[model samples]
Target: MRLARFRHDGRVRTGVVEGDHVLPFEGDPGMLEIIDGSAEQRTAGPVPLDDVKLMAPLQPRTLRDFVAFEEHVEGVRRSIDGSSGVPEAWYDAPTFYFTNPHRVYGPDDDIPFPARSVDRDFELEVAVIAGPEQSIFGYTILNDWSARDLQRREMQVSLGPAKGKDFASTLGPWIVTADELDPYHEEGFLDLWCTAQVNGVEVGRDLLSNMGWTFETLIAYAARDSRVMAGDVLGSGTVGNGGCLAELWGRNGKQDPPPLRDGDVVTLTVDGIGSLTNRVVTGPQTGDLPPVRRRDQAQARAERQH
Candidate 1:
């Protein structure tokens, strides 16, 4: 079942998708209702998905996206050094970031390309939302659009990716229950056909089998010390073999990359799950607003406690 969250009458709601309609779910994290709730309990009010505004499927406390694709890793290395390689440490170290899961885009929602953004690119990936409040659940399509210029500038300060990735991170038409995807989940060879389209034009495609680390490994690594609660999302960093701009080819055009323009629609589709399309739009601002609310504040507080 495709589970989602939406806003109607100024309040956010949880629901499941059935064809063109959405069925509302009443619970804390819909995952609970999905796993244990009866068929009737799981079903609720229905509305046309196209008519109502969709929000991020889950209200995650935190998000961690990991680079699970080796081809993408090599592609990035070759772009940066011309050596076609990275240090051995990269293999051992799974790089990741704590992003604001609250800043999610829904189907048909408009994603604002920040004013500071110079090299805006789309990353077609799979996002995972944890279930059982402790166990890692599964994966879904994730489009981690990036502003390369801002990312590069901020990384030099060593406080990095904070300014770069904070604007927005897109996820879900809905969260697919783990059991629903079990048949496709394997050590190797999960036929994950994924692709990206910008303004209705195709740009990228890849398969899940290309990833360097499997979902299980990512979960084990992520669960080291931190408790991964229900609704926490994890992204399969840019897919193997040029999944996004940085990984694919770099600085080849006249400018860095085309900043997502107003009305530009970006669609990401994963074969089994479904498709998520978002329009590019400027967030509420006078000129170029200060970036959206800071997400790292919560991370900072978490770190202080430790």
Candidate 2:
């Protein structure tokens, strides 16, 4: 079953998507609750899909994004850090980072470009929403918008992808229940093709099977010594051979194609799930916010002596 959270007649409602219409439920029993088997799939009336405004399928309790694609890692490292190979530890374990859940964007929403970014890029990925008994409730498309310039500068500190990645992440259109994808499951991996398009032009494509680490493995790693509760979201990072402008430039040595600009429509599609489309719009200028600065260790020691 495909489920969606939307606003109709100025009130937010949750519903199961049936074709182009949604079978609305009476109360707002959050998507997570429905996934946990606490809420029933009862319907009230059908609402036309075009009449309602879509929202993120659910408000995630926590968001964890993992780097599970080797090609993506290699391409990024070679492009940004001049490295020809991945880190040795990456082979032994899945690595991930927590992102701001408050900045989530739903399908058809306009994503504002971060003020500090000149090189904005989109990461095409798939994400799983956790349900009861450590099982997956549903799947959705995830677009991890990145400010590559900010990310590069911050990584120099060896601590974070912080402000660089916390700006915005896009999810939804709707969630496709695990049962809907059972046909595609084989040997613990779902065989689905994921694609990304910029303004209707195909830019990247890859199969979910290309991922080096499975979603189950990534979730297990995340749950170690930590509670993986309902509503927690785990992203399957960028797919193998997915193209961001940086990776394209690194591979082809062509920089003529510009980075994401205002009015660019990015669409990510995963075969079994659905397509998530978002537009890029310029945001309000950053006023009075200082640019990032490097801390001088020598100057700090001299000040401590005083």
Best TM-score goes to which candidate?
2
State each model's CA lDDT, in order: 0.70, 0.85
Query: Candidate 1 lDDT, tens digit per residue, 208-287?
Result: 77777766666668888866766567787887644676765642423323546677788888878888898877555437
By summed lDDT, which 10 consecutive residues of candidate 2 come out lowest? 248-257
Backbone clash tally for model 1? 1
- lDDT against true structure, model 2: 0.85
Cα lDDT tens digits, model 2, 28-147, are 777877877888777888889999999999889999999888888887776666677788988988999999999999999999977768888888989999887677888998988988
How many times do residue backbones clash in model 2? 0
> TM per model?
0.81, 0.93
- Per-residue lDDT, model 2, residue 44, is 88
TM-score, structure 1 vs. true: 0.81
